[model samples]
Target: MSASDPRPAAPRAAPALPGVAGNPRRPYVRPMAGWWLRNPYFVRYMAREGTAVFVAAYALILLVGLVRLAQGEAAWNGWLEALRSPLSTILHLVFLAVFVFHTVTWFEVLPKTMPPLLVGGKRVAQSAITAGAIAVAAAASLALFGIVWGLTR
Candidate 1:
Protein backbone atom coordinates (compact mmCIF):
# COMPACT_ATOMS: atom_id res chain seq x y z
CA MET A 1 0.00 0.00 0.00
CA SER A 2 2.87 2.35 0.83
CA ALA A 3 5.17 3.54 -2.00
CA SER A 4 8.31 2.54 0.02
CA ASP A 5 7.02 -0.97 1.00
CA PRO A 6 9.63 -3.70 0.23
CA ARG A 7 7.22 -6.73 0.51
CA PRO A 8 6.54 -8.48 -2.85
CA ALA A 9 2.89 -8.43 -4.03
CA ALA A 10 0.99 -11.72 -3.74
CA PRO A 11 0.66 -13.72 -7.00
CA ARG A 12 -2.80 -13.62 -8.54
CA ALA A 13 -4.73 -16.91 -8.45
CA ALA A 14 -5.97 -18.58 -11.70
CA PRO A 15 -9.62 -17.86 -12.42
CA ALA A 16 -11.88 -20.61 -11.14
CA LEU A 17 -13.94 -22.59 -13.61
CA PRO A 18 -17.66 -22.78 -12.83
CA GLY A 19 -19.05 -26.33 -12.14
CA VAL A 20 -15.65 -27.87 -13.01
CA ALA A 21 -13.33 -29.06 -10.18
CA GLY A 22 -10.00 -28.43 -11.92
CA ASN A 23 -8.59 -26.82 -15.05
CA PRO A 24 -8.62 -29.15 -18.07
CA ARG A 25 -5.27 -29.13 -19.94
CA ARG A 26 -6.14 -30.57 -23.35
CA PRO A 27 -8.42 -28.95 -25.90
CA TYR A 28 -11.25 -30.96 -27.45
CA VAL A 29 -10.45 -32.32 -30.94
CA ARG A 30 -13.10 -32.65 -33.62
CA PRO A 31 -13.36 -35.95 -35.51
CA MET A 32 -12.72 -35.80 -39.26
CA ALA A 33 -15.36 -38.39 -40.17
CA GLY A 34 -18.15 -36.91 -42.32
CA TRP A 35 -16.53 -33.45 -42.14
CA TRP A 36 -17.66 -32.73 -45.70
CA LEU A 37 -21.29 -33.00 -44.66
CA ARG A 38 -21.03 -29.94 -42.43
CA ASN A 39 -21.42 -27.50 -45.32
CA PRO A 40 -22.05 -27.42 -49.09
CA TYR A 41 -18.83 -25.51 -49.70
CA PHE A 42 -16.82 -28.10 -47.76
CA VAL A 43 -18.49 -30.90 -49.73
CA ARG A 44 -17.62 -29.24 -53.02
CA TYR A 45 -14.06 -28.53 -51.90
CA MET A 46 -13.52 -32.07 -50.70
CA ALA A 47 -14.97 -33.51 -53.89
CA ARG A 48 -12.58 -31.32 -55.87
CA GLU A 49 -9.63 -32.42 -53.72
CA GLY A 50 -10.66 -36.09 -54.10
CA THR A 51 -10.38 -35.79 -57.90
CA ALA A 52 -6.58 -35.76 -57.63
CA VAL A 53 -6.60 -39.48 -56.87
CA PHE A 54 -8.59 -40.21 -60.01
CA VAL A 55 -6.33 -37.94 -62.06
CA ALA A 56 -3.25 -39.72 -60.74
CA ALA A 57 -4.84 -43.09 -61.55
CA TYR A 58 -5.50 -41.92 -65.10
CA ALA A 59 -1.91 -40.71 -65.41
CA LEU A 60 -0.67 -44.10 -64.24
CA ILE A 61 -2.89 -45.76 -66.85
CA LEU A 62 -1.31 -43.58 -69.53
CA LEU A 63 2.16 -44.45 -68.25
CA VAL A 64 1.26 -48.11 -68.47
CA GLY A 65 0.19 -47.59 -72.08
CA LEU A 66 3.52 -45.93 -72.79
CA VAL A 67 5.34 -48.83 -71.20
CA ARG A 68 3.31 -51.28 -73.26
CA LEU A 69 4.20 -49.32 -76.43
CA ALA A 70 7.87 -49.69 -75.56
CA GLN A 71 7.44 -53.45 -75.14
CA GLY A 72 6.45 -53.92 -78.84
CA GLU A 73 3.64 -53.44 -81.34
CA ALA A 74 1.77 -56.49 -80.09
CA ALA A 75 1.84 -55.27 -76.48
CA TRP A 76 0.77 -51.80 -77.52
CA ASN A 77 -2.08 -53.18 -79.62
CA GLY A 78 -3.13 -55.42 -76.74
CA TRP A 79 -3.25 -52.42 -74.39
CA LEU A 80 -5.32 -50.50 -76.92
CA GLU A 81 -7.69 -53.43 -77.31
CA ALA A 82 -8.04 -53.66 -73.54
CA LEU A 83 -8.81 -49.96 -73.41
CA ARG A 84 -11.61 -50.54 -75.90
CA SER A 85 -13.45 -52.77 -73.40
CA PRO A 86 -16.64 -51.62 -71.65
CA LEU A 87 -14.99 -51.55 -68.21
CA SER A 88 -12.14 -49.39 -69.46
CA THR A 89 -14.61 -47.10 -71.22
CA ILE A 90 -16.64 -46.68 -68.02
CA LEU A 91 -13.50 -45.92 -66.00
CA HIS A 92 -12.36 -43.36 -68.54
CA LEU A 93 -15.77 -41.67 -68.41
CA VAL A 94 -15.58 -41.44 -64.64
CA PHE A 95 -12.06 -40.06 -64.88
CA LEU A 96 -13.22 -37.46 -67.37
CA ALA A 97 -16.01 -36.31 -65.04
CA VAL A 98 -13.60 -36.04 -62.15
CA PHE A 99 -11.12 -34.10 -64.28
CA VAL A 100 -13.83 -31.65 -65.33
CA PHE A 101 -14.93 -31.11 -61.72
CA HIS A 102 -11.32 -30.55 -60.67
CA THR A 103 -10.72 -28.07 -63.48
CA VAL A 104 -13.85 -26.03 -62.73
CA THR A 105 -13.15 -25.92 -59.00
CA TRP A 106 -9.53 -24.93 -59.69
CA PHE A 107 -10.59 -22.04 -61.89
CA GLU A 108 -13.16 -20.93 -59.33
CA VAL A 109 -10.47 -20.76 -56.65
CA LEU A 110 -7.73 -19.23 -58.84
CA PRO A 111 -8.80 -15.63 -58.44
CA LYS A 112 -8.89 -15.98 -54.65
CA THR A 113 -5.39 -17.44 -54.57
CA MET A 114 -3.72 -15.05 -56.97
CA PRO A 115 -3.20 -11.30 -56.72
CA PRO A 116 -5.97 -9.22 -58.27
CA LEU A 117 -5.47 -8.28 -61.92
CA LEU A 118 -5.86 -4.71 -63.18
CA VAL A 119 -6.93 -3.97 -66.74
CA GLY A 120 -6.40 -0.37 -67.93
CA GLY A 121 -6.10 0.81 -64.26
CA LYS A 122 -9.34 -0.89 -63.24
CA ARG A 123 -9.52 -4.06 -61.12
CA VAL A 124 -10.71 -7.04 -63.15
CA ALA A 125 -13.86 -8.85 -62.05
CA GLN A 126 -13.25 -12.34 -60.59
CA SER A 127 -15.91 -13.90 -62.83
CA ALA A 128 -14.28 -12.39 -65.91
CA ILE A 129 -10.88 -13.65 -64.76
CA THR A 130 -12.24 -17.20 -64.30
CA ALA A 131 -13.97 -17.10 -67.68
CA GLY A 132 -10.84 -15.81 -69.38
CA ALA A 133 -8.77 -18.56 -67.75
CA ILE A 134 -11.21 -21.24 -68.89
CA ALA A 135 -11.19 -19.82 -72.42
CA VAL A 136 -7.40 -19.88 -72.55
CA ALA A 137 -7.37 -23.46 -71.28
CA ALA A 138 -9.93 -24.51 -73.89
CA ALA A 139 -7.94 -22.86 -76.67
CA ALA A 140 -4.72 -24.59 -75.52
CA SER A 141 -6.53 -27.93 -75.31
CA LEU A 142 -7.93 -27.53 -78.82
CA ALA A 143 -4.51 -26.60 -80.21
CA LEU A 144 -2.96 -29.66 -78.57
CA PHE A 145 -5.74 -31.85 -79.93
CA GLY A 146 -5.22 -30.48 -83.44
CA ILE A 147 -1.47 -31.10 -83.26
CA VAL A 148 -1.99 -34.64 -82.06
CA TRP A 149 -4.58 -35.34 -84.74
CA GLY A 150 -2.28 -33.99 -87.45
CA LEU A 151 0.61 -36.15 -86.25
CA THR A 152 -1.53 -39.30 -86.05
CA ARG A 153 -3.17 -38.86 -89.42
Candidate 2:
Protein backbone atom coordinates (compact mmCIF):
# COMPACT_ATOMS: atom_id res chain seq x y z
CA MET A 1 0.00 0.00 0.00
CA SER A 2 2.97 2.29 0.48
CA ALA A 3 4.79 4.08 -2.35
CA SER A 4 7.24 1.21 -2.90
CA ASP A 5 5.24 -1.74 -4.20
CA PRO A 6 2.13 -2.21 -6.37
CA ARG A 7 1.32 -5.75 -5.18
CA PRO A 8 -0.89 -6.45 -2.18
CA ALA A 9 0.80 -7.25 1.15
CA ALA A 10 1.59 -10.91 1.86
CA PRO A 11 0.15 -12.75 4.88
CA ARG A 12 1.90 -12.00 8.21
CA ALA A 13 1.69 -15.65 9.39
CA ALA A 14 4.68 -17.97 9.48
CA PRO A 15 5.01 -20.24 6.43
CA ALA A 16 3.71 -23.78 7.00
CA LEU A 17 5.86 -26.87 6.66
CA PRO A 18 5.05 -28.60 3.36
CA GLY A 19 3.85 -31.84 4.98
CA VAL A 20 2.00 -30.29 7.91
CA ALA A 21 -1.77 -30.91 7.66
CA GLY A 22 -3.00 -28.23 10.13
CA ASN A 23 -2.22 -24.53 10.44
CA PRO A 24 1.50 -23.75 10.15
CA ARG A 25 3.70 -22.97 13.15
CA ARG A 26 7.10 -21.30 13.38
CA PRO A 27 10.00 -22.96 11.53
CA TYR A 28 11.90 -25.57 13.51
CA VAL A 29 15.15 -24.41 15.06
CA ARG A 30 17.96 -26.87 15.82
CA PRO A 31 19.59 -26.78 19.28
CA MET A 32 22.78 -24.68 19.23
CA ALA A 33 24.43 -25.96 22.43
CA GLY A 34 27.48 -28.21 21.97
CA TRP A 35 27.49 -27.60 18.21
CA TRP A 36 31.23 -26.76 18.16
CA LEU A 37 32.00 -29.97 20.06
CA ARG A 38 30.35 -32.10 17.35
CA ASN A 39 33.00 -31.38 14.71
CA PRO A 40 36.84 -31.41 14.88
CA TYR A 41 37.00 -28.46 12.49
CA PHE A 42 34.61 -26.49 14.65
CA VAL A 43 36.69 -27.30 17.74
CA ARG A 44 39.90 -26.02 16.15
CA TYR A 45 38.16 -22.93 14.78
CA MET A 46 36.65 -22.10 18.16
CA ALA A 47 39.98 -22.62 19.93
CA ARG A 48 41.72 -20.27 17.52
CA GLU A 49 39.02 -17.61 17.96
CA GLY A 50 39.01 -18.04 21.74
CA THR A 51 42.71 -17.03 21.97
CA ALA A 52 41.59 -13.45 21.47
CA VAL A 53 40.53 -13.33 25.13
CA PHE A 54 44.10 -14.02 26.26
CA VAL A 55 45.43 -11.53 23.70
CA ALA A 56 43.10 -8.88 25.07
CA ALA A 57 44.14 -9.72 28.61
CA TYR A 58 47.84 -9.24 27.77
CA ALA A 59 47.07 -5.97 25.94
CA LEU A 60 45.21 -4.71 28.98
CA ILE A 61 48.12 -5.66 31.23
CA LEU A 62 50.50 -3.69 28.99
CA LEU A 63 48.06 -0.79 28.95
CA VAL A 64 48.06 -0.78 32.75
CA GLY A 65 51.85 -0.67 32.74
CA LEU A 66 51.78 2.32 30.40
CA VAL A 67 49.30 4.04 32.69
CA ARG A 68 51.53 3.30 35.67
CA LEU A 69 54.58 4.71 33.86
CA ALA A 70 52.68 7.90 33.17
CA GLN A 71 51.82 8.22 36.84
CA GLY A 72 55.53 8.16 37.97
CA GLU A 73 58.62 6.01 38.42
CA ALA A 74 57.28 4.61 41.73
CA ALA A 75 54.04 3.39 40.11
CA TRP A 76 55.95 1.95 37.16
CA ASN A 77 58.37 0.17 39.47
CA GLY A 78 55.44 -1.29 41.42
CA TRP A 79 53.94 -2.60 38.18
CA LEU A 80 57.29 -4.14 37.18
CA GLU A 81 57.61 -5.71 40.62
CA ALA A 82 54.11 -7.14 40.39
CA LEU A 83 54.93 -8.74 37.02
CA ARG A 84 57.88 -10.57 38.63
CA SER A 85 55.55 -12.65 40.84
CA PRO A 86 55.18 -16.44 40.39
CA LEU A 87 51.54 -16.06 39.28
CA SER A 88 52.46 -13.47 36.65
CA THR A 89 55.28 -15.69 35.35
CA ILE A 90 52.93 -18.69 35.06
CA LEU A 91 50.28 -16.56 33.35
CA HIS A 92 52.86 -15.26 30.87
CA LEU A 93 53.99 -18.85 30.09
CA VAL A 94 50.40 -19.79 29.35
CA PHE A 95 49.99 -16.66 27.19
CA LEU A 96 53.17 -17.62 25.29
CA ALA A 97 51.78 -21.08 24.47
CA VAL A 98 48.41 -19.68 23.44
CA PHE A 99 50.06 -16.97 21.34
CA VAL A 100 52.20 -19.56 19.55
CA PHE A 101 49.15 -21.68 18.71
CA HIS A 102 47.18 -18.61 17.64
CA THR A 103 50.00 -17.44 15.37
CA VAL A 104 50.30 -20.88 13.71
CA THR A 105 46.56 -21.12 13.12
CA TRP A 106 46.40 -17.57 11.76
CA PHE A 107 49.21 -18.27 9.33
CA GLU A 108 47.59 -21.57 8.30
CA VAL A 109 44.49 -19.69 7.13
CA LEU A 110 46.39 -16.86 5.38
CA PRO A 111 46.63 -18.70 2.06
CA LYS A 112 42.87 -19.36 1.96
CA THR A 113 42.11 -15.71 2.68
CA MET A 114 44.36 -14.18 0.03
CA PRO A 115 44.05 -14.21 -3.77
CA PRO A 116 46.13 -16.94 -5.45
CA LEU A 117 49.69 -15.84 -6.02
CA LEU A 118 51.09 -16.67 -9.46
CA VAL A 119 54.81 -17.34 -9.68
CA GLY A 120 55.98 -17.77 -13.33
CA GLY A 121 52.40 -18.64 -14.42
CA LYS A 122 52.04 -21.25 -11.68
CA ARG A 123 50.40 -21.01 -8.29
CA VAL A 124 52.68 -21.15 -5.25
CA ALA A 125 52.23 -23.90 -2.67
CA GLN A 126 50.39 -22.99 0.55
CA SER A 127 53.04 -24.57 2.79
CA ALA A 128 55.69 -22.35 1.20
CA ILE A 129 53.56 -19.26 1.71
CA THR A 130 52.89 -20.17 5.34
CA ALA A 131 56.52 -20.95 6.11
CA GLY A 132 57.62 -17.74 4.43
CA ALA A 133 55.21 -15.73 6.53
CA ILE A 134 56.36 -17.39 9.76
CA ALA A 135 59.98 -16.83 8.81
CA VAL A 136 59.35 -13.16 8.13
CA ALA A 137 57.63 -12.78 11.50
CA ALA A 138 60.47 -14.52 13.35
CA ALA A 139 63.10 -12.41 11.62
CA ALA A 140 61.21 -9.23 12.43
CA SER A 141 60.88 -10.31 16.09
CA LEU A 142 64.58 -11.13 16.31
CA ALA A 143 65.59 -7.81 14.76
CA LEU A 144 63.38 -5.92 17.15
CA PHE A 145 64.74 -7.86 20.11
CA GLY A 146 68.32 -7.21 19.02
CA ILE A 147 67.65 -3.51 18.59
CA VAL A 148 66.05 -3.27 22.03
CA TRP A 149 68.76 -5.29 23.68
CA GLY A 150 71.48 -3.21 22.09
CA LEU A 151 69.77 -0.01 23.15
CA THR A 152 69.28 -1.25 26.74
CA ARG A 153 72.90 -2.33 27.04
Candidate 3:
Protein backbone atom coordinates (compact mmCIF):
# COMPACT_ATOMS: atom_id res chain seq x y z
CA MET A 1 0.00 0.00 0.00
CA SER A 2 2.94 2.37 0.76
CA ALA A 3 5.64 3.49 -1.71
CA SER A 4 8.24 2.21 0.72
CA ASP A 5 7.17 -1.38 0.02
CA PRO A 6 9.51 -3.21 -2.37
CA ARG A 7 6.70 -5.17 -4.04
CA PRO A 8 5.00 -3.78 -7.12
CA ALA A 9 1.24 -3.11 -7.13
CA ALA A 10 -1.07 -5.87 -8.47
CA PRO A 11 -2.07 -5.40 -12.10
CA ARG A 12 -5.76 -4.82 -12.87
CA ALA A 13 -7.62 -7.42 -14.96
CA ALA A 14 -9.27 -6.20 -18.17
CA PRO A 15 -12.93 -5.40 -17.65
CA ALA A 16 -15.42 -7.87 -19.10
CA LEU A 17 -16.62 -6.69 -22.52
CA PRO A 18 -20.26 -7.75 -22.53
CA GLY A 19 -21.32 -4.96 -24.91
CA VAL A 20 -20.88 -1.97 -22.59
CA ALA A 21 -18.58 -0.38 -25.21
CA GLY A 22 -14.90 0.20 -24.42
CA ASN A 23 -11.71 1.02 -26.30
CA PRO A 24 -12.14 0.58 -30.09
CA ARG A 25 -8.46 -0.36 -30.44
CA ARG A 26 -8.58 -3.38 -28.13
CA PRO A 27 -7.86 -6.68 -29.91
CA TYR A 28 -10.94 -8.85 -30.43
CA VAL A 29 -11.05 -11.80 -28.05
CA ARG A 30 -12.64 -14.93 -29.46
CA PRO A 31 -15.13 -16.77 -27.24
CA MET A 32 -13.62 -19.98 -25.89
CA ALA A 33 -16.75 -21.99 -25.10
CA GLY A 34 -17.93 -24.54 -27.71
CA TRP A 35 -15.26 -23.48 -30.22
CA TRP A 36 -14.65 -27.13 -31.04
CA LEU A 37 -18.27 -27.60 -32.17
CA ARG A 38 -17.75 -25.09 -34.98
CA ASN A 39 -14.94 -27.04 -36.62
CA PRO A 40 -15.08 -30.70 -37.77
CA TYR A 41 -11.34 -31.21 -37.22
CA PHE A 42 -11.46 -30.01 -33.61
CA VAL A 43 -14.65 -32.01 -32.96
CA ARG A 44 -12.92 -35.19 -34.18
CA TYR A 45 -9.83 -34.41 -32.17
CA MET A 46 -11.84 -33.90 -28.97
CA ALA A 47 -13.86 -37.08 -29.54
CA ARG A 48 -10.67 -39.09 -30.11
CA GLU A 49 -9.17 -37.69 -26.91
CA GLY A 50 -12.43 -38.35 -25.02
CA THR A 51 -12.14 -42.06 -25.82
CA ALA A 52 -9.23 -42.29 -23.38
CA VAL A 53 -11.66 -41.94 -20.48
CA PHE A 54 -13.56 -45.00 -21.62
CA VAL A 55 -10.28 -46.89 -22.09
CA ALA A 56 -9.24 -46.03 -18.58
CA ALA A 57 -12.62 -47.07 -17.19
CA TYR A 58 -12.31 -50.45 -18.94
CA ALA A 59 -8.83 -50.91 -17.55
CA LEU A 60 -10.07 -50.18 -14.05
CA ILE A 61 -12.84 -52.74 -14.50
CA LEU A 62 -10.25 -55.35 -15.48
CA LEU A 63 -8.08 -54.45 -12.52
CA VAL A 64 -11.04 -54.89 -10.24
CA GLY A 65 -11.63 -58.33 -11.79
CA LEU A 66 -8.04 -59.23 -11.09
CA VAL A 67 -8.46 -58.18 -7.49
CA ARG A 68 -11.66 -60.22 -7.19
CA LEU A 69 -9.93 -63.24 -8.68
CA ALA A 70 -7.21 -62.99 -6.09
CA GLN A 71 -9.82 -62.79 -3.35
CA GLY A 72 -10.97 -66.35 -4.25
CA GLU A 73 -13.92 -68.15 -5.93
CA ALA A 74 -16.91 -66.34 -4.48
CA ALA A 75 -15.52 -62.91 -5.27
CA TRP A 76 -14.48 -63.96 -8.75
CA ASN A 77 -17.90 -65.47 -9.46
CA GLY A 78 -19.56 -62.26 -8.25
CA TRP A 79 -17.44 -60.18 -10.57
CA LEU A 80 -18.29 -62.49 -13.48
CA GLU A 81 -21.96 -62.25 -12.63
CA ALA A 82 -21.75 -58.49 -12.57
CA LEU A 83 -20.32 -58.53 -16.05
CA ARG A 84 -23.09 -60.84 -17.23
CA SER A 85 -25.76 -58.24 -16.51
CA PRO A 86 -27.66 -56.68 -19.43
CA LEU A 87 -26.37 -53.23 -18.50
CA SER A 88 -22.77 -54.44 -18.50
CA THR A 89 -23.30 -56.12 -21.91
CA ILE A 90 -24.65 -52.87 -23.40
CA LEU A 91 -21.83 -50.90 -21.81
CA HIS A 92 -19.28 -53.26 -23.32
CA LEU A 93 -20.83 -52.72 -26.77
CA VAL A 94 -20.60 -48.95 -26.32
CA PHE A 95 -16.98 -49.30 -25.21
CA LEU A 96 -16.29 -51.42 -28.29
CA ALA A 97 -17.65 -48.69 -30.59
CA VAL A 98 -15.67 -45.96 -28.85
CA PHE A 99 -12.53 -48.12 -28.97
CA VAL A 100 -13.00 -48.67 -32.74
CA PHE A 101 -13.38 -44.92 -33.27
CA HIS A 102 -10.24 -44.28 -31.22
CA THR A 103 -8.29 -46.89 -33.19
CA VAL A 104 -9.36 -45.51 -36.60
CA THR A 105 -8.61 -41.92 -35.63
CA TRP A 106 -5.24 -42.98 -34.23
CA PHE A 107 -4.31 -44.84 -37.40
CA GLU A 108 -5.46 -41.94 -39.60
CA VAL A 109 -2.91 -39.73 -37.86
CA LEU A 110 -0.18 -42.41 -37.79
CA PRO A 111 1.46 -41.20 -40.99
CA LYS A 112 1.96 -37.73 -39.59
CA THR A 113 3.13 -38.99 -36.18
CA MET A 114 5.69 -41.47 -37.53
CA PRO A 115 8.49 -41.47 -40.06
CA PRO A 116 7.73 -41.92 -43.76
CA LEU A 117 7.57 -45.42 -45.13
CA LEU A 118 9.55 -46.36 -48.23
CA VAL A 119 9.72 -49.60 -50.16
CA GLY A 120 12.15 -50.22 -53.05
CA GLY A 121 13.12 -46.52 -53.19
CA LYS A 122 9.46 -45.45 -53.43
CA ARG A 123 7.49 -43.67 -50.73
CA VAL A 124 4.24 -45.33 -49.65
CA ALA A 125 0.94 -43.45 -49.75
CA GLN A 126 -0.57 -42.19 -46.50
CA SER A 127 -3.82 -43.97 -47.26
CA ALA A 128 -1.88 -47.21 -47.82
CA ILE A 129 -0.12 -46.82 -44.50
CA THR A 130 -3.37 -46.18 -42.69
CA ALA A 131 -5.14 -49.05 -44.40
CA GLY A 132 -2.24 -51.44 -43.81
CA ALA A 133 -2.10 -50.59 -40.12
CA ILE A 134 -5.84 -51.01 -39.70
CA ALA A 135 -5.72 -54.31 -41.58
CA VAL A 136 -2.92 -55.59 -39.36
CA ALA A 137 -4.78 -54.53 -36.20
CA ALA A 138 -7.95 -56.27 -37.40
CA ALA A 139 -6.00 -59.45 -38.21
CA ALA A 140 -4.35 -59.46 -34.79
CA SER A 141 -7.67 -58.90 -33.03
CA LEU A 142 -9.27 -61.76 -34.95
CA ALA A 143 -6.37 -64.09 -34.21
CA LEU A 144 -6.59 -63.31 -30.51
CA PHE A 145 -10.34 -63.85 -30.49
CA GLY A 146 -9.89 -67.22 -32.22
CA ILE A 147 -7.33 -68.28 -29.66
CA VAL A 148 -9.61 -67.28 -26.77
CA TRP A 149 -12.57 -69.09 -28.34
CA GLY A 150 -10.48 -72.23 -28.87
CA LEU A 151 -9.36 -72.20 -25.24
CA THR A 152 -12.86 -71.58 -23.90
CA ARG A 153 -14.24 -74.44 -26.03
Candidate 4:
Protein backbone atom coordinates (compact mmCIF):
# COMPACT_ATOMS: atom_id res chain seq x y z
CA MET A 1 0.00 0.00 0.00
CA SER A 2 2.77 2.46 -0.96
CA ALA A 3 2.85 5.14 -3.74
CA SER A 4 5.67 3.20 -5.51
CA ASP A 5 3.48 0.02 -5.86
CA PRO A 6 2.91 -0.39 -9.62
CA ARG A 7 0.73 -3.56 -9.26
CA PRO A 8 -3.02 -2.88 -8.87
CA ALA A 9 -4.73 -3.89 -5.58
CA ALA A 10 -6.66 -7.17 -5.60
CA PRO A 11 -10.29 -6.80 -6.74
CA ARG A 12 -13.01 -7.11 -4.08
CA ALA A 13 -14.78 -10.50 -4.10
CA ALA A 14 -18.54 -10.68 -4.79
CA PRO A 15 -20.63 -11.27 -1.60
CA ALA A 16 -21.57 -14.96 -1.20
CA LEU A 17 -25.29 -15.62 -1.35
CA PRO A 18 -26.85 -17.89 1.33
CA GLY A 19 -29.38 -19.80 -0.83
CA VAL A 20 -28.59 -18.97 -4.50
CA ALA A 21 -27.24 -21.84 -6.67
CA GLY A 22 -23.80 -21.41 -8.21
CA ASN A 23 -23.36 -21.51 -12.03
CA PRO A 24 -27.07 -21.30 -12.73
CA ARG A 25 -27.51 -21.70 -16.51
CA ARG A 26 -30.69 -20.88 -18.42
CA PRO A 27 -32.66 -23.87 -19.76
CA TYR A 28 -32.42 -24.31 -23.55
CA VAL A 29 -35.78 -23.96 -25.19
CA ARG A 30 -36.09 -25.33 -28.71
CA PRO A 31 -37.23 -22.70 -31.23
CA MET A 32 -40.34 -23.39 -33.30
CA ALA A 33 -39.11 -24.12 -36.83
CA GLY A 34 -42.49 -23.57 -38.48
CA TRP A 35 -43.72 -20.70 -36.33
CA TRP A 36 -44.29 -18.44 -39.36
CA LEU A 37 -46.42 -21.11 -41.05
CA ARG A 38 -48.77 -21.21 -38.07
CA ASN A 39 -49.56 -17.47 -38.24
CA PRO A 40 -50.82 -15.48 -41.25
CA TYR A 41 -49.23 -12.28 -39.90
CA PHE A 42 -45.83 -13.94 -39.60
CA VAL A 43 -46.12 -15.33 -43.13
CA ARG A 44 -46.99 -11.89 -44.47
CA TYR A 45 -44.13 -10.24 -42.60
CA MET A 46 -41.65 -12.86 -43.83
CA ALA A 47 -42.93 -12.51 -47.40
CA ARG A 48 -42.57 -8.74 -47.13
CA GLU A 49 -38.95 -9.12 -45.96
CA GLY A 50 -38.24 -11.73 -48.66
CA THR A 51 -39.16 -9.16 -51.33
CA ALA A 52 -35.95 -7.33 -50.43
CA VAL A 53 -33.96 -10.07 -52.25
CA PHE A 54 -35.95 -9.52 -55.44
CA VAL A 55 -35.59 -5.75 -55.04
CA ALA A 56 -31.84 -6.14 -54.74
CA ALA A 57 -31.79 -8.38 -57.83
CA TYR A 58 -33.82 -5.81 -59.77
CA ALA A 59 -31.38 -3.08 -58.68
CA LEU A 60 -28.43 -5.16 -59.90
CA ILE A 61 -30.20 -5.81 -63.22
CA LEU A 62 -30.78 -2.08 -63.62
CA LEU A 63 -27.14 -1.40 -62.78
CA VAL A 64 -26.08 -3.91 -65.46
CA GLY A 65 -28.42 -2.23 -67.95
CA LEU A 66 -26.89 1.15 -67.13
CA VAL A 67 -23.43 -0.30 -67.58
CA ARG A 68 -24.45 -1.75 -70.95
CA LEU A 69 -25.96 1.59 -71.99
CA ALA A 70 -22.72 3.34 -71.11
CA GLN A 71 -20.77 0.90 -73.26
CA GLY A 72 -22.61 2.04 -76.49
CA GLU A 73 -25.87 1.83 -78.44
CA ALA A 74 -24.98 -1.73 -79.57
CA ALA A 75 -24.49 -2.93 -75.98
CA TRP A 76 -27.65 -1.16 -74.82
CA ASN A 77 -29.68 -2.70 -77.66
CA GLY A 78 -28.29 -6.14 -76.81
CA TRP A 79 -29.27 -5.70 -73.17
CA LEU A 80 -32.76 -4.59 -74.23
CA GLU A 81 -33.07 -7.64 -76.48
CA ALA A 82 -31.98 -9.92 -73.64
CA LEU A 83 -34.73 -8.38 -71.50
CA ARG A 84 -37.26 -9.50 -74.14
CA SER A 85 -36.34 -13.18 -73.61
CA PRO A 86 -38.89 -15.47 -71.95
CA LEU A 87 -36.71 -16.10 -68.88
CA SER A 88 -36.08 -12.39 -68.47
CA THR A 89 -39.82 -11.69 -68.85
CA ILE A 90 -40.65 -14.28 -66.17
CA LEU A 91 -38.01 -12.84 -63.84
CA HIS A 92 -39.37 -9.33 -64.44
CA LEU A 93 -42.90 -10.54 -63.60
CA VAL A 94 -41.63 -12.05 -60.34
CA PHE A 95 -39.73 -8.85 -59.54
CA LEU A 96 -42.91 -6.78 -60.22
CA ALA A 97 -44.94 -8.99 -57.85
CA VAL A 98 -42.27 -8.72 -55.14
CA PHE A 99 -42.06 -4.93 -55.68
CA VAL A 100 -45.86 -4.58 -55.28
CA PHE A 101 -45.79 -6.73 -52.13
CA HIS A 102 -42.94 -4.65 -50.67
CA THR A 103 -44.70 -1.36 -51.47
CA VAL A 104 -48.06 -2.45 -50.01
CA THR A 105 -46.47 -3.86 -46.85
CA TRP A 106 -44.38 -0.68 -46.44
CA PHE A 107 -47.51 1.49 -46.63
CA GLU A 108 -49.38 -0.78 -44.21
CA VAL A 109 -46.53 -0.52 -41.67
CA LEU A 110 -45.92 3.23 -42.21
CA PRO A 111 -48.72 4.46 -39.93
CA LYS A 112 -47.63 2.18 -37.10
CA THR A 113 -44.09 3.60 -37.33
CA MET A 114 -45.29 7.23 -37.35
CA PRO A 115 -46.91 9.28 -34.59
CA PRO A 116 -50.70 9.63 -34.88
CA LEU A 117 -51.31 12.00 -37.75
CA LEU A 118 -54.07 14.60 -37.29
CA VAL A 119 -56.10 16.20 -40.02
CA GLY A 120 -58.88 18.69 -39.20
CA GLY A 121 -58.20 18.19 -35.45
CA LYS A 122 -58.92 14.48 -35.71
CA ARG A 123 -56.57 11.53 -35.93
CA VAL A 124 -56.42 10.16 -39.47
CA ALA A 125 -57.06 6.48 -40.09
CA GLN A 126 -54.12 4.31 -41.15
CA SER A 127 -56.08 3.21 -44.24
CA ALA A 128 -56.49 6.85 -45.23
CA ILE A 129 -52.78 7.52 -44.86
CA THR A 130 -51.92 4.39 -46.88
CA ALA A 131 -54.45 5.34 -49.57
CA GLY A 132 -53.05 8.86 -49.77
CA ALA A 133 -49.51 7.49 -50.14
CA ILE A 134 -50.62 5.05 -52.87
CA ALA A 135 -52.47 7.83 -54.67
CA VAL A 136 -49.39 10.04 -54.68
CA ALA A 137 -47.27 7.13 -55.95
CA ALA A 138 -49.75 6.38 -58.73
CA ALA A 139 -49.82 10.03 -59.80
CA ALA A 140 -46.01 10.23 -59.88
CA SER A 141 -45.81 6.98 -61.85
CA LEU A 142 -48.38 8.21 -64.40
CA ALA A 143 -46.50 11.50 -64.77
CA LEU A 144 -43.25 9.62 -65.40
CA PHE A 145 -44.99 7.34 -67.91
CA GLY A 146 -46.37 10.36 -69.73
CA ILE A 147 -42.96 11.99 -69.91
CA VAL A 148 -41.34 8.81 -71.19
CA TRP A 149 -44.14 8.23 -73.71
CA GLY A 150 -43.85 11.80 -74.98
CA LEU A 151 -40.11 11.56 -75.36
CA THR A 152 -40.36 8.21 -77.17
CA ARG A 153 -43.00 9.56 -79.55
**lDDT leader:** 3
Pairs clashing within candidate 1: none
Tens-place lDDT digits, model 3, residues 1-153:
898999999999887665556645556688999999999999999999999999999999999999999999999999999999999999999999999999999999999988888999999999999999999999999999999999999
Q: Number of backbone collisions per candidate, in order? A: 0, 0, 0, 0
TM-score of each: 0.78, 0.81, 0.81, 0.77
Return the lDDT, model 2, position 38: 96
Identify the runs in model 4 with alpha carbons over 4 angstroms from their true place. 1-26
Candidate 1, residue 15: the lDDT equals 83
Per-residue lDDT of candidate 4, residues 1-153 (tens digit): 888999999999886554456735555666889889988999999999888888888889999999999999999999999999999999888887778778888988989999999989999999999998888877888899999999999
Best to worst by lDDT, what's the order?
Answer: 3, 2, 1, 4
For each candidate in the order shown, give its overall lDDT on alpha carbons: 0.90, 0.94, 0.95, 0.89
The residue pairs in collision within model 4 are: none
The sequence of per-residue lDDT tens digits that candidate 1 reaches over residues 56-151 is 898899999999999999999999999999999999898878887788889999999899899899999999989989889889989999999999
